[model samples]
Target: MNSNYSAQEKNFATALLHNLWKYLLLAASIVATVKIIFFGFDIDE
Candidate 1:
């Protein structure tokens, strides 16, 4: 049915957005770790 398809489409869109956010967070975390390592922050802390 049209309604069922619509709901499935909406769920797929939500999942895509969720994955995008997850990747963004992972990238940010990696950048932060790199920054800290470059600054030698881990040696003291």
Candidate 2:
């Protein structure tokens, strides 16, 4: 029973991490888009 619970917990943690990374990437892209819209796309400067 304890082992089963541990396995479930581990799976939950893995899923949480996966979702966290997904959201982080989404947030980063949104921030980048906002920056480009406000600042213009001046990569050289």
Candidate 3:
């Protein structure tokens, strides 16, 4: 029973981490796009 509980806890943690990274990547891309739109970026300069 304890092992089963631990397994379930680990699964939940894995899912949480997965979602966290997904959202973080999504947010980072959005922020980058907004920054580029508003402030612009210069690679050649």
**Winning candidate number (lDDT):** 1
Local lDDT at 24 for model 2: 100
The lDDT per prediction is 0.95, 0.92, 0.91
| TM-score (all chains, Cα) for each model | 0.64, 0.81, 0.80
Could you give the candidate ranking by TM-score, starting with the highest?
A: 2, 3, 1
User: RMSD, model 2, all Cα superposed?
Assistant: 3.5
lDDT of 2 by residue, 1-45 (tens): 699999999999999999999999999999999998767756645
lDDT at position 36, candidate 1 = 83
Model 2: how far residue 39 lies from native, Å: 0.7
After superposing candidate 3 on the true structure, give the runs of residues whose Cα lies further than 4 Å from its correct spot.
41-45
lDDT of 3 at 9: 99
lDDT of candidate model 1 versus the reference: 0.95
Once fitted onto the true fold, the runs of candidate 2 whose alpha carbons sit more than 4 angstroms away are: 41-45
Note the residue pairs that clash in candidate 1.
none
Per-residue lDDT of model 1, residues 1-45, tens digit only:
699999999999999999999999999999999998978976777
> 5 in model 1: Cα distance from truth in Å?
2.7
Candidate 3 residue pairs in clash (backbone atoms < 3 Å): none
